[model samples]
Target: MFSLKAALAVPFAKFIVKKEQKWINNPLETQERVFQDLINDAASTAFGVDHEFASIKSHADYVKRVPIRDYEDLKPYVDRVVAGESDVLWKGKPLYFAKTSGTTSGAKYIPLTKESMPTHVAAARNAILSYIHETGNAKFVSGKMIFLQGSPVLTEQNGIQLGRLSGIVAHFVPKYLQKNRMPSWETNCIDDWETKVEAVVKETLPEDMTVISGIPSWVQMYFEKIQEKTGKKVGDVFKNFNLFIFGGVNYEPYRAKFESLIGRKVDSIELYPASEGFFAYQDKQNEKGMLLLLNGGIFYEFVPADEFFNENPIRLTLKDVKVGVNYVMIISTNAGLWAYNVGDTIMFTSIKPFRVIVSGRIKHFISAFGEHVIGKEVEQALKEGIEGSNFQISEFTVSPQINPESGLPFHEWFIEFENNVENVSDLATKIDAALQEQNSYYFDLIKGKVLQPLKISEVKKNGFQTYMKSVGKLGGQNKIPRLSNDRVIADKIYDLNLIK
Candidate 1:
């Protein structure tokens, strides 16, 4: 079922990749120079805001200008840009505004300008370069590089859409380059995997796929499927791959499953990206730590965790950031977001030239499977489910996972629903179903056989709070995986069933 046209693209793609890498990795500090120039431009705009008429520029003055702005303060500015005004923020028309599911609040709109395209490409494509470095192979078999991210078209009326940054670029790249992209601009990913995309993943010989990019979890799921279909372990598929790259977060939760598939450690490129913008990515194949910030297109201002999100924040230069402490990353990019708070947290790995590890989100996530599921969704659903039922409880935690037997991924709600809610299991299922009936992607996942239904784990009274208390973050971060669609974990949750 593989397209002959797609097959023919492989050789040309391989050649183009080499040329692209050359353009992407000019001189070592070349990006930094581009970054400095971009910063000077943003600062010039920020500084000129003074004289009701207009003003002048100072390299030091830009740095010393007003403190970095956060999400709340920049809302009005973003609104102005959306309305297409000649506001102080964006100088030109919106090329495209990449969106994020704004992990903390609603949705985020990160604008892109013609000026910033190369930086995005460099940050994203380096994963390919890093793969060649780590795996020591770049030769290919066949098939186009498949990317799993958000649809190029926006769906939700108002919400920060979560997706890989590469998804947006697939549509905008020139038609000559279009042959390298997957079919259709209307395709859905993440919440709803495209059938053709899934089929390509299923049908292609692992050896044939030289490069693969997707969320870590979905790739793991695909790896498992490839094994089931071919009766061959992951090593068979990986041996053929010149590179394996994943975006989203740390691959630790998936480490065991992925390793099991490959039967050995397959080198991978871990990318750091946001739906709002393609941020930083690994610069070297051997580098297994924090990504080098794409400082070329974005002016960065780090706010110390202790003081960063405060009423007033003190900014840190690329040179001033300290190691071993958490900091909120703020970026003023060519994408028209100035001092925009993306709401993710990080700790420095090295302080000299600047390297940091992704700690976790500033928002709430149990992070059990590292799924990045919002705790509020589960909590809100359970609250709504127990509406009339007399389920009494001080607190609760809901973990979602795949039901291996049914072959459908569903939520196995681990709940501490308040007292006297008879039939918590049945009520939990009802609430889960209701949520999906309202939320289309979850519904599509069910219809398309991507996810199973929902089940409940009835916790014995004090268990929920006790679990949270044991983790040192009683009132804070530590909870459990709100979303896990993995078989290994889901099976355990199902077998335990909270009754045991």
Candidate 2:
């Protein structure tokens, strides 16, 4: 029965792929249409009236009316929506609020309107369908699929349901996939991440698990637990488990560790999803970047990352964006996020069909001594430095060590290694060289003796996990920032004595 159903989905998947090619081929047109639709739909809402959306005709006109806003800047309007005010941001009350923890603000409620909610589900399904179309492998669809996400339990706020984005998405799993989904509802409701993983392990032990999906860090924990329970690799236990779907964090740094955990290389799909909107997904098996979703009810604006903080930075449309430049992604979505900065920095790998890789967050960087180093640069440096070596990194983070007790100040890297490196000092030197090669500012800083070379602090086994647990953010969409301007996380790691 499962095989027959899987066979039936192939044709449907191919059809969807063919249909998506239209928008992919006409990116600018599709974005313009989405932008116009958003404006027209919410013309009667309070935000539209305040911004004079009814009079807005073009991207230029819209931009002139709506200034770019972060969460804090837009909170006033969002508060009205949360206070049971209809048509405050969108046309009506949001179907759900994706509750996310903010750095400065407590909890952020990102509204998911009726018109916007389906895009999240559709994009995820399309990512899978695109994979099937490209690889012609649908047999995995017949087996059990597990999404390691938050509990489906949601609380009500005003007239809207509120939960973590993953939890809210849990309630929208397609009926066809309901039976194939693993970790029964009761098991999924467990709040403790460790306990939930154990429950998931016991339930999925006897099943033919095929697709495993979650954030890479949390998924690594799951794989570790599975190995602990079975005394075998994940690939050995589940022969058919071939596809790994991951989002939230970059998977390149974790690739070597994951391959070791699974005991084999498996196909993986990288998704660019957030509480605001589903932005992109890996559409090709061998592609370097995910296909940016132009027709997915989002109007994108790009501001060059370097100029992002400047007074009135240039906001370029899709057609004006250039390849290889890191830009802060701004979006006006059907969900009523007007000129909103999603906070992600993306570098366009391709212009035709529009593909992008999330480079890093705009706010997450290390520039203490005027050597601005972004997340992508650091990840690339580590990957290049550790290339072909037996050293496997479990997790790592970088921070600026402004006031060193002994030597001139330098960048500090806290890394949890899965295996021991023969010489940590040599590895650190290689990584520093890689970073210097990529970033000229960093290179000049080192040459001018403004900053010393980067240093690595070995984190004991599961040290990052211990630090996260200490702060009450062990799992469930929580991830460690790759770079920090301050030593907040570094100090905490020291406090817990997780450093070697």
Candidate 3:
């Protein structure tokens, strides 16, 4: 019925793909132009003037002039902007504040201005458009594509609009495609996640759902609800469901469960986006990494993951980065963030094309007793350990138990499963053995008895979901931290006493 939509988009999508391919071939040149443009645009802002933007001639000068900052360092300026200050960070007041989950450093309000909206909104749109162009799969756009996003109902803080990042992006969906979007505004605005999912299920079930997009976890929930309501797998209900677009969390561990829920495998694409920016996306199939958005409105820097916590670490630009080294990402963007650490770590897989895989977050590493382990290691271990296991993990988090009262320093895994395990001890041992093989530091700790072997606690059904609800992080784009450095969140999970 809507073949015209496919025909019209094909030419434009091809143009974008061709342009991106050429830009990616010359990443350094593209990045330099982006950085220069950002500096020129924000030269009059408070931060720009304070850092003497006029004197910044190169990436080195910019780095030296503006010290790397995290959200805490920029909070004062952001607060002033929230209080109606103009030109504090950008040329004018922000159009909205993207409220991120407080899971790590507490809830943060990232400013979003008109100049920045195109980068965030258009990049996401291009992910799909690029997929259609590269794979010649535009028919999906002819049918409904449900994006499981946060409620667009925003709050006004000191005359500035604020809401979840996903919600803000949803408001900017192109008018041409509004007819194919699902979940009415009222249905999307439901405060409770459980209620919202049910409403979304009802609204989208009777429609032609060709593409489903969101975090894998929430999409899994929506699939389960659909199966429960109709006694049929998601694919059976939506025969045209062909593409799955996901981000916000690694999909490796959840792939098995997602396939099981859908009752078959579906082509999927991954995106790397945060409240701060849209960073990368899968440009081709059967690829292990995402192509970085080099020509986007952002400048990139990398600090060696091993040296990121050091007092002074060497910084590398796009020209000097090496594939396979885990690096903490820093960026300067059109949105007024300069040399800012968004807390994510990534490793490049293809230097020529600048493709990267998200490794983990800096704060989300376990190093309580010098057994420093990152999210990538833990996830890899779990995937290997569960390869042939009878049960599947729905969600999990690991933390250090350092107190002697807890019986020696050790790593504790609180896991929620899709099905109960036959032998908990065996599962725990397999996971520990797998982790030890991947991380020598952890192996040494266990060998030297500085830390005991890892321990596991099986969670009751819906335990993690209930905990997320209690903390008001129940819906779209929020995810369980795979690893924590301290016992803060782990203690709460232990207190839940959902052990099976």
- Candidate maximizing lDDT: 2
List where candidate 2 sits over 4 angstroms from the true fold.
none
The alpha-carbon lDDT assigned to residue 326 of candidate 2 equals 94
RMSD vs true structure, all candidates:
14.5, 0.9, 1.7
**Model 1 regions lying over 4 Å from their true place:** 1-36, 39-65, 103-106, 130-136, 141-144, 153-164, 172-191, 194-207, 237-239, 365-500
Task: Give the alpha-carbon lDDT of every model.
Answer: 0.54, 0.94, 0.87
Which tens-of-lDDT digit does each residue in 1-500 have in candidate 3? Answer: 54998888889899888877788888888998998998888888998899899888898898789888999898888878878889988888888999986544687889888877788877888888888887887888888988898899999998789998889888998998899888898998887889999999999989999999999888888998999999999999999898999998899889888888898999999999888889999887877899899877889999998998788788899889998888999998877888999999999999878899999999899998888899999999889888887677788899888884756778989888898577877878888999999889999999998999888878888788877877678878888889999887777766766666
Alpha-carbon lDDT of model 3: 0.87
Candidate 1 lDDT, 160-240, residue by residue in tens:
232334556665564534544543454443234435346645545533455666766456546656787778876676565
Pairs with steric clashes in candidate 3 = none
TM-score: model 2 vs. ground truth = 0.99
List the candidates ranked by TM-score, beginning with the highest: 2, 3, 1
C-alpha positional error of residue 169 in candidate 3 after TM-score superposition, expressed in Å: 0.9
TM-score for each of the candidates = 0.60, 0.99, 0.96
Candidate 1: 10-residue stretch with minimal lDDT: 470-479
Report backbone clashes per prediction.
11, 0, 0
